[model samples]
Target: MGQANNKTVLLPLAFALGLAGLAFLPAVHGNPKTFAAFLGVSAALSAWDALLFVSTRRGGRTLSVDVALKKQHYLQACVQGSLMAYWGYYWPPVYAFAPFILAQLVFAYAFDMLLVWSRRDVYTLGFAPFPVVVSINLFLWFKPDWFYLQFLIVALGLAAKELIRWNRDGRRTHIFNPSSFPLAVVSVFLLAAGKSDITWGQSIATTQFYPPNMYLVLFLLGMPGQFLFGVTTMTMSAVVSTYVFGRLYFAATGIYFFYDSYIPISVFLGMHLLFNDPATSPRTELGRIIYGSLYGLSAVWLYQLLGSAGMPTFYDKLLQVPLLNLSAKWIDRVAGQWFTLGRSLTARQRNLAYMSIWAVIFAGMSATQGVGDSHPGQWLPFWRQACEDGRAYACPYLADLETSFCDRGSGWACNEAGLLHIALSRSGEDLRRADPAGAAVPLRRGCELGFATACQNLNTLTSGTGSFARAQPTIEDLPIILRGSKGEIRERDPSALYALACHEGWPDTCGRSPLTANSLP
Candidate 1:
């Protein structure tokens, strides 16, 4: 390929990735359109790079060979990559795009190099694109129909890094975190234009909790970066602030404001990984404390704001970093001028003290069920009540939970989801989205799946009957632990038809736990 001594050979690796991507396509799990667009973009980029090099005689001989690499970039990339792999163990949607995500790494490299070299003579390449591309993929991705937009988001971020600048500590620095700037900007558009469905933002937020002990997984993955970079203060402060705020909120309202935890898994993820970028974040310890506090407090505020506005709250973490980045210099200047008590201690010592405090707090939080696998909010009873109470995210979450169960062939869940959908459609209070017709889909499926209640509900919905005419789903009972096959279970009480029924998914019979199987001892 370089027989003519071509300066830009159009990365062979890009073509290699296109071949690899077919393996992850629809048969296994990805949207085919998205992969096609990605592959096409890869081809176009290679063609353009080769054309530029051949014609202009100006394109650099090597892509980023002359650029100095930074430790934090690759370190952050590894951490983010490990996280996605672990989470993918419990979720296919996250894993289905392995090749596509890798393609972004190539895109970021060639496109970033192309953008730079097209403007100037010498281009310095490093691992700058690694963290940026990987981080964006970690949080949100586009639907296949709108897959091209994902490229736009990536382009905006990469370009903004080069175009947007401010003088910080005598060097021309980016005003906003490269990845975060595009996220916040795009979020504003999504919220304002009512187009959030184009991306998988909310699905990512919910599915993130699917992995067992995910909170701990994230904490462990985040520690190396914290240890190496001395960014513990920011993470620690953010955690403490959010934990305290959530505790106080629960104390006042008797409900967890963040829903499933004192701190939500995804938001906690943001605290650890997303907003703690040392380069764009506050440099001084005091400034970091304030910056982290604001991030935490603003997350709470933004969650409420977005929720109240009927927008997805996954944006809460994203919308703040850009704003915080804009303020970081001011914060450093102000806090540096104000706080001088730490002058006696070495920077390393202060960082150690911060890490020590954070470790203690994290331990306490884990020990106290503040950010772990088990929480009361995870139960159906809590969601059932919250849905009735019109908590902004509650009905949708409850509906999603039941719908997932329905998809798994649980007729009881289908019935439950149909009821919730009907209620949501009729109420018209929160999102004002009425999917009355969509309610029949689940009810009909439930009936076909052998849940009698769902059959009755389907009849009610299809027969043009009124709203919720049948029954509301009850979480007062959970499925009892039946320990045998249908035949063995029936053999326990050979005459008991109800035994057969319970084993066959009769909610009324299966609902009674063995502990309460009989009231009279």
Candidate 2:
């Protein structure tokens, strides 16, 4: 490849890295080594394509080189999609996720082919559907039990691409990006159905690595695509608007709107890759600004509203894109109107209108502001029920409730909290702050309340001399500690044998025999 091709890829790639550096550099937290590892790997993966795109070009300015470049794009998509699926498969929650990913990809590819075979012309060797399916599936991997629901999402998203379109600028264009549309619609449904109460852990946290290596790779690989579309303006506008809006929101509400930092890596991907879908977004300059601003504002509003209502904030940022996509025609017309009007009016008047519109929107948002749930205690019952119904993911949340209750001086709750902490710690995450002697704080608290089991557990943890892991309790211990002393018996209960009954209504004679016994308590 020549200098021109290098510039095309390199410039946007540099711009993306620069923005990431600005966001992450100032407020450094977490392990730098982890972040560095992610950054380096992502850069390498991204550069692999860049090098290929550069090296595989035909000799000189020929028509076939353009065709070859197009093929490179498709190859890049395939390579990236394969790599992403492999990563998802190999990532934590391993086996359960990989099969679903393969299933979705196969379904998406076949669906796209059927559309093409019927003369609908939406097939691209799985390029379009592959990324959409894999990325969404990867994000939704946290809730593996909801396989049927995930399948529905993939089907609906593909169906939307074929079915939903509008006549725009003398050509029919899909109203929404396939994945974005389905994600937005499903997010709303999930919130309404109370499904959002379940934990849909962020993409990064779901990964085995600390710094979210998968997302970092995605952000890098996605940069060239964003550049190819020349929608960097939209990405910039959306990111900047979100940053400013978050600050203003925090100032007014005293609550952090997004993450601890405004522009986390996740936010960067949401802005650039998800929100800036060139096919669905507006083409004109003013339209891009309005579209991006609307997205940023709508995201913040939806996040606050849904999060206040006790729904997960995982999909809040991505939900508004499809909603906004529906208004592309109107937005294009408005941008055109602005362009014409700007030629007639003074620059000051244009600026005034911009400020005035934003002011009104912000003012309305402020007036309708809701006080989000300050106390997570209120959601304990619902979370508990969800946890009970085979949703093992709810353990972390139940632990949170017990922790909160224990903090309020409930001795039993303290014990429960200690047990949960130990359970979680045994499973790879140590919620307890004390290292080596995990769960000691809660156990000590319970012990002070005359809880014998808590004291014993605390002793086990601190001493670090138990064959049975101190972080977890035995089954027999649960019966003794949880059931109290009322059912105490020196002998083990034997399997009962029924004898002949004299009357229908009479209780039958039962026989019991104990074979073996061991010292327990």
Give me the candidate number with maximum TM-score: 1
**Top lDDT prediction, candidate number:** 1
After TM-score superposition, what is the CA distance of residue 352 in candidate 1 from its true location, in Å? 2.2
Q: What's the lDDT of the predicted structure labeled candidate 2? A: 0.52
How well is each residue in 90-204 modelled by candidate 1, as lDDT tens digits? 7887777676676566667767766775665456666888889888887888777777677777878999998889888999987777888888888889889999999898888
lDDT of 2 by residue, 1-521 (tens): 32233233233244234423432432221446433432443354345435533543432321110112353236445645654554545454444345445545654554444443234212244256665775565345435334446656776887787888898888987887877777777777776787753435454322422223433354446545544455555665665587687668656644335533344444555665567677788977688788888876776777678666656766656678887888877898888776654556554454455445543543443343211111112234334454555354466656765675555555555666776677677675434432435578878887786656677777777787662222222222222322211122123232211111111111222331223321111
| Model 2, C-alpha of 120: deviation from truth (Å) | 5.6
Off by over 4 Å in 1: 1-32, 54-64, 383-409, 413-449, 453-521
Clashing pairs in 1: 67-125
> Cα deviation in Å at residue 263, candidate 1?
1.8
Cα RMSD (angstroms) for every candidate in the order listed: 7.0, 20.5
